[model samples]
Target: MAFSPLVDQLLDALRVLPGVGPKTAQRMAMHLLERDRDGGRQLARVLMQAAEDVGYCQRCRTLTEQPLCELCESPRREDRLLCIVESPGDMLAIEEAGGFRGRYFVLHGHLSPLDGIGPDDLGLDALDAVMEQAGVDEVILATNPTVEGEATAHYLAQQLKPRGVTLSRLAYGVPMGGELEYVDGGTLSRAFMGRQPFND
Candidate 1:
């Protein structure tokens, strides 16, 4: 049986979300159509609002409703200590841990030469500008433990070494190849607490 064009369209649109497949999308569309019109409308409104108003922080590259995120604007955050992470999700994970009192630099993604992503693509220039402007004293390379993440951390450390900033990497509590966003708050806090210097 062919689904109505509207239903199909809704399912297709929802499938764009990560980990959502055709079955889940179709189920969600059905649920929205059958019992949740108001909820669906609210979701649509929020989606549109976020798409229109949310943007990357000028300094950290984290998604925010304003030009600079709260973390960047907050006076309590340490200016000299910078924790670099692969994405805003990772930043949120660290924030949830409630142990890191410093600022962050969100890379948005890790280096993946096979996927055609390089330093320029990851906003290395913006990072350099932040390092210089903020007078960053220590940079904690909190990228994931994956191969691509390690490569990105190494590349960044090398590039920033001449800038005279202390560089460190998160401890190995986060499993190999695991993303920071998936690690629990306690583990992430411990990892940050036990970070080791990134030599080389």
Candidate 2:
């Protein structure tokens, strides 16, 4: 029995998402065909719309529909305190914990020289511009606990040290090599609360 081209194409497209293996993709294709035409159409429409409309914030580099993300646009947020995170999801996690009242800067990725990522690739220039324009007094490096995250944090610390802003790193409550998105809300909140100044 041969599967139709459309079915095979749907399965292949679904597999592009992380953790969606061939089996899961096939199952999803079958399920969409068997039980969910309206839902599938809505899903496709929303995915296309989001892909076309969502873009990175000019200030923080977080995904946003507007020129700047909500965090950057908010006037109530503490502009003097900035938290540097690897991705928008990490920013969301910290926001959800409700412990951080400061602004955020999303790097979009960690420094991984083996994978060809570098400081310039992570929008450090924009970050520097933001710091200069906003008169940021403190920068909290809230990147994940992974090796690359640590490396990125250290690199940023070194570069920004002479800029005269107080630099701090998130506390060690987050397990080593763990991602910010996967850590529990309590742990993330505690990490923010216990953050220490990075003198080096």
Candidate 3:
């Protein structure tokens, strides 16, 4: 027998999450109903609050609940360097790595002409404005290593180069401790193109 209308509706709603399939959605609904009603209610409350309160940072476009994200509002982060990423998730990854101390600009997405996504959709104008205002000396393009991401990075380089800013893309290379035999051809080519002299 099929689920009731309410259960079916919940299942459909759950499936809207990325990578969630029908069976997974059904399992989630069943788990919520059978053993985790309170947890489900808490999840619903937090989700609604986050959806309503969260907004893009005014300066960097990262997701936040204030006019500017904490990073943009901080006094310690370097102002002369800006890292452009494709999403808030990417920004979070860089933060977790603890390597970069510069500010950031979140693009939210890449340029995908086939999907109707463009520079305007990615807020490149806003990025330019921030660069102009902040007097950024260097810009690091940290977009994903995909065709669309490469196109977007190249386009950004062209636009920002005339402004006298030092534009650079994140170095593409084999991961530390990764076996070169397992590396893909494209990555191997990039690593070769971006080769540097031995340090020690």
Candidate 4:
């Protein structure tokens, strides 16, 4: 026989997470029901609270429970250099990578006309307003290297270029430690195309 209605609902809910298939969801549901009901309840409570409370930062648009995220509130962050990322996760990745101490502005998603996403949806108007204010000297576009991302970057460039602020994009290529033989053709091609001159 199949799972009960509630169990099936739990499995379906679990499947909403990225990379979680039916089997994975079932396994998770089973583990929660059989082994750790308390943990599952705690997770549910916290998840509900976070889902209800979390909202975009007023300045950066990254998810936060407060009016401004920690990054935006931090006085230690550079005011003149701003990095634009497609998601909060992307911003986190760059933060974890270290070295760059600039501020960030998150665009929840790239521009997708077919999906009904537009510049307004991506917070371009807010960005324009932010750029209009003094202090931000440069903007680094850290959007993913996809078609939509490219289009978004190009659009931002066109909008921001006239403002006289320097604009830059993150370069894509092979991973630092990966061998060329194992690298994909597309990656290798980009690596070659983005090749930099070595200094003596």
Clash pairs detected, candidate 1: none
> What RMSD value applies to candidate 4?
1.7
lDDT of each residue in 1-200, candidate 2, tens digit only = 65898888898899889999988998898899999989999999999999999999999889998998877888998889999999989999999989898899999999998999988889999998899998899999999888899899999999999989999987667888999999999888878988878998
TM-score of predicted structure 3: 0.95
- Predicted candidate 3 versus true structure: per-residue lDDT over 43-155, tens digit per residue: 99999999999999989999999999989999999999999999999999999999899999999999998899978999887897898899899999999989989899999
- Candidate 3 CA-lDDT value: 0.93
List residue ranges in candidate 1 displaced over 4 A: 173-200
lDDT of each: 0.90, 0.90, 0.93, 0.91
Task: Please give the TM-score that candidate 1 achieves against the real structure.
Answer: 0.85
How many backbone overlaps does candidate 3 show? 0
Residues 1-200, model 4: lDDT tens digits? 78999998899999989999999999999999999999999999999999999999988999999999999899898888989999999999999999888899999999999999988898887787667663889999888988999999998888888878899998889998889999999889999999999999
- TM-score of model number 2: 0.85
Per-residue lDDT of candidate 1, residues 1-200 (tens digit): 76988887888899899999999998898899899999999999999999999999999999999999999999999999999999999999999989999999998899998889888888888898898898789999999988899899999989989888889997666777989899998778878877878999
Task: Tell me which of candidates 2 and 3 scores higher on lDDT.
Answer: 3
Q: Which 10-residue window in model 3 sums to the lowest lDDT?
A: 123-132
Residue 165 shift from truth in candidate 1, angstroms: 1.5
- Model 1 lowest lDDT segment of ten: 169-178
Give the lDDT of residue 10 in candidate 4: 92
Q: Cα RMSDs of all predictions? A: 6.6, 6.5, 1.2, 1.7
Name the better of 2 and 3 by TM-score: 3
